[model samples]
Target chain A: AQSVAQPEDQVNVAEGNPLTVKCTYSVSGNPYLFWYVQYPNRGLQFLLKYITGDNLVKGSYGFEAEFNKSQTSFHLKKPSALVSDSALYFCAVRDSVSGTYKYIFGTGTRLKVLA
Target chain B: EAEVAQSPRYKITEKSQAVAFWCDPISGHATLYWYRQILGQGPELLVQFQDESVVDDSQLPKDRFSAERLKGVDSTLKIQPAELGDSAMYLCASSLGLERINEQFFGPGTRLTVL
Candidate 1:
């Protein structure tokens, strides 16, 4: 079975400051990790993904994530946060060896970019 | 700027009523997914379709919930005699399926309230 964990229920960051949202996962095989953001009353938007090769992956809206194999973690980071960045963030993982496209998602982390 | 489309942005229905949601994937997307998201939680996959065939429906409540991707283009999800617990957001996502690295594009989602 595959699963994801987002330890933080909420993260508050000042606008223009750095922001980080942590995520971890457990899977039977290699993992394909992804990050998504959702605004209130809207659907989720893809931020970035880590399949292979790169430990650091850049995404849209100036967001990026670092994949740590030893820690089984993929933490989302943004150098300069914006007010518009406040939203619900989710971390997801899929087992690369399972031959299944099913994605397991974390409970989610609420990010608040305070001005 | 092709995007997945979902119908009925909001729906409020009485308990025991029947409800349905629709989605249209991007022009060339080969994989479609339906997910249910409760408040303060990540989206959970209800079903997945590869083209017009069902790839996975193990998580779906087959007793009351049914889904289909008829022409490999559009899909529908139906819930009969909806219960109060059924109130949540229904999200539709699609992926190109051309490569394992393709990101899924999501719809705005339909917020359902079974009162």
Candidate 2:
């Protein structure tokens, strides 16, 4: 089974401070990892994806992710946080082994960027 | 930016009543998906469509939930006899369905509140 885990239910950080949201995964084969952000009353927006690239991948809104295969982790990070960055973050893994192209998402972590 | 469209941004209904949500995916996207997102949780895949055919629906509660994308352009998800547990956000997404690019584009989502 392919699954992702986001251990934190909420993470608070002050504006201009660096932020990190933890994510780990379990997969039978090579994992396709992705990060998504959801604002209140809105759908999720894709942040970044890690397939088979340089471990560090940059994404929209100055966000990035570091893919660590040995640790089975793909953590989302930002150099500096902004009040508008507050939202729900999710980590997902694509189950290609099942040949269904289905995404298995984590429980989600609410990010509160305080100004 | 071509964005997906969803109707009835908010819906409130009593239990046992029928409710339906609609989605229009981005133009030229071949794959579509429906997801249910509960508060404080990540979105769960309910159904996926490749054109007008159903590709996967293992997680869907077929006893009361149904989805269709007859023309492959727009889709609809219907829940009969809605239950309090059914209160959630219905999210629709679409992808190019190509092997290399699997990132999905999502709609704003429909929020349902079942009393």
| Highest-scoring model, lDDT | 2
Off by over 4 Å in 2: none
Model 1 score (lDDT): 0.92
Clashing pairs in 2: none
Worst 10 residues of 1 chain A by lDDT: A94-103
Residue-level lDDT tens digits of model 1 in B1-115: 9888999999999999999999999998998999999988999999989899887888999999999988899999999989999999999999987346677899999999999
Give the TM-score comparing model 1 with the true structure, all chains together.
0.97
Please provide, for model 1 over A1-115, each residue's C-alpha lDDT reduced to its tens digit, 9 standing for 90 to 100. Answer: 7889999999999999999999999988678899999999988899999988889999999999999999999999999999999999999987555555777789999999999
Candidate 1 Cα errors over 4 Å, as ranges: none
Residue B6's C-alpha lDDT in candidate 1? Answer: 97
Docking class of 2: medium
TM-score on 0 to 1 scale for chain A of candidate 2:
0.98
Error of 1 at B10 (Å): 0.7
Candidate 1: residue pairs that collide: none
Clash count for candidate 2 is 0
